[model samples]
Target: MVGRKKRTTICDKELQKEDLISNLHEPLISEILLRLSTKDAVRTSLLSKRWRYLWQTVPGLDLALYDFLNINFSNIDAFFKFVERFFDSHRESWIRKLRLYLGYRHHICGLKSWIDAVTRPKIQHLDVNYYSSDEIPVSIYTCETLVHLRLEWVSLPNTEFVSLPCLKIMHLKRIRFTSDTTLEKLISGSPVLEDLKLFGCSNHNAIQLRSHTLKKIDMDMDHSSGFVIDAPLLQCLKTKIASTKDFQIISSGFPAKLDIDLQWRRRRPLERPPKKVIRDILADIRRVSDLVITSDILKEFFLYSKSRTVRQFRNLSRLHARFAICDIEMLPALLESCTKLESLIMVI
Candidate 1:
């Protein structure tokens, strides 16, 4: 037993850990870094020598260009220098995706320079959530390499030339266009665009969305008028009932899943929709496969059914109805109309 104290194992020398994460394959590390926020990814540089430049090799602004550009810094000129260094570092690299939440008022000028720097690279996915009143750089409209673009609350000026051959997805929300034609030009330029989402966008002038390539459209405007969508291959169209109680949807009958949600409002007894009018609207929505509406709308159809006929929803498979107290009795009528409805959600 006394002799047991004599041996010192080699395992004791392994006190300094193996650092298994750093030894992982380079691509795996890059992917892990990609999941991190642009700021957090760059901060890995301070962890160890192996991690120092690995983050820079990660795709897009995972290299953390946004860290220098997006912050509301006190010494913006200094941050601009860091931005220049970031571009210089990536002069030969391909940045596929970049997201910039451009901060409060003061950083606009430097932020534009940051945006300009990105234009040099073959950027595919660009998300700019800008808060400033000034327009984003027009060069963005002509980015041939952009595959996905999201612009929110930014003023977009009408540019002479717009071309995005590779763009497949576009999300435009609360965008202020110098002219309504700017939106038309942008959509027309994105030849391969398949999915488009518009939220809180209002246009007084006529804009034509004539996209053969478009498969899905999600538009939710508080007030929209004089816009037309001619998507022949349209697979889905999701929209809010714009103009308060006026539901106008062009069901192309291309197996499109049209989503309609009716917003409720109090009206005088005389202001109720005419019996024939409700029947006409119901007939128009006969092909909408997905329908979400208030139960009160069912009451309209119920009252109309007593006089004129209610059209059968042959295509409707899903229905989500929010019930108002007085309109709950009309539930049976709604169920009777949607003969093929497989999924029904009745909200109390």
Candidate 2:
């Protein structure tokens, strides 16, 4: 009797729970749908007539060519048609975010028009990862309302007008800039940018990163490319020095956490040892508390030192090193330099 009573109570509650969600206001339903992916949001239309256009009116739009409506990859035209319909049918006063990903080169033809349609009056976040030779829309450079911008595998535009007054976070990977100054113009215009990351970007032999408001920077560069950092308030820096040019950090002080990857010195009749470039960087950042370095840095650096004393790095507290068997002789020299080290990590 007790078990039967429990089953009856559960069924009674299920019967009492009607379509309460449908009874809510359209604003509430739209808010609920906005939290869903664009494809899942459109699926709600099957639930009832009230949800027919709720997805189109959402504040955020996330559309990828592969995931939209389960479109067939064999027919690329169908995907384009769906995108056109979504742009034409959807209406919004302000879009908070738009994350778009295009897979193939054929999609480049429609990129300009699609960018225009989505560059609304108050779009804040725009993330686009489209691989193509075509340049991204020029409107993106002057997006005043954008706060966070992330681009990958896209060609940057060359325009006289470059302004992003509200931009805070910027991340670019595999981007092809028209010229070296094209990136500089964008960085100069962003008055409030803080966090920056660059990985495997091309079309520049030497890039100068001069910013007053920048706090953190992480980058990867080739042996032919170089960086000139001049951020006064930078807190942390992680980058590789592969250039022969003597680079300097024009900061008030070295970053708190300095993660550096030093290149190997070339031994030849013409090319000389890179003791000065490696030593200058270490001397400039000697005040850093936490440091991560490779064995090549110690190999070329400590081998040229006249004395094995620990006078350079008096403020270093934590040291992490990836030591190789060939350069294990310099490990003792590095440890001997960090007199104030509280933590030591080694990878052999």
- Residue 208 lDDT in candidate 2: 79
- Each model's lDDT comes to 0.71, 0.76
Candidate 1 lDDT, 185-242, residue by residue in tens? 8889989999999888888765788787998888877566656777778887776653
Q: Which stretches of candidate 2 lie over 4 Å from their true place?
A: 1-54, 67-74, 203-206, 223-225, 243-246, 263-273, 295-309, 320-336, 343-348
Q: lDDT, candidate 2, residue 307?
A: 65
Residue-level lDDT for 88 in candidate 2: 67
Over the full model, what C-alpha lDDT does candidate 1 score relative to the true structure? Answer: 0.71
- The 10-residue segment of model 2 with minimum total lDDT is 264-273
Question: Per-residue lDDT tens digits of candidate 2, residues 1-348?
Answer: 999999999988775674677777888877887767777888888877877877777777777876653543446687777667766665546677777787655555687877766664677888888988889888888888999999988899788878899999999988888877888788888999999988787644566778999999888754335667889888888877664533457666667888887654432434545666756766755768888888766665665663632666668898888998887877676777777889999999
lDDT, candidate 1, at 260: 56
Query: How displaced is residue 80 in candidate 1, in Å?
Result: 4.6
Using lDDT as the measure, the top candidate is 2
